[model samples]
Target: MIDATHDTNGTRYKLFSFMTHDVFGHGQYVKHALMENEGSECLTDAVTSFKYVNPTWEKVRVIIVEKGFGDISLL
Candidate 1:
């Protein structure tokens, strides 16, 4: 699933909010999919929430791309 909100500047921000629990022996996984507003608070919130779930988990990698014509198409 996805959640979206508009910022003070009326720019639309998208966040991927979903969780999977007990995937592998009580391990919890959170997936933050596509984010529209890069460098915005929304992205920070997404990363924060993911870390909050499992603080010990290390970040494997990260990739940032500029917003474009259609987000859904990227999905």
Candidate 2:
């Protein structure tokens, strides 16, 4: 989880993770995206949703966010 405070607004990201996408002949590439706000459920609702939606994606370990905005939590 990552949390940061800013003058304008604070942002929070929860359940950060990394995944790999394999291209037939080109080899495998690391793919990941961070979703901020939305609270703890973001993992179950958003992160896990991707896993269910994209069956081809391999499970990657959860990422440790060292820097970000607002208050975030790992699910």
Q: Give residue 13's lDDT in candidate 1 (0 to 100).
A: 48
lDDT of 2 by residue, 2-60 (tens): 22222433444433444443445342323344555445555445556656766854544
lDDT of 1 by residue, 1-75 (tens): 234433634445454554443546462435654566645455566666666776754543333333542243332
Off by over 4 Å in 1: 1-29, 32-39, 59-75
What is the TM-score (0 to 1) of candidate 1? 0.34
Give the TM-score of each candidate: 0.34, 0.33
Range of the 10 consecutive residues with the lowest summed lDDT in candidate 2: 1-10
Error of 1 at 32 (Å): 4.8
lDDT of 2: 0.43
Model 2: how far residue 26 lies from native, Å:
10
| Winning model by lDDT | 1
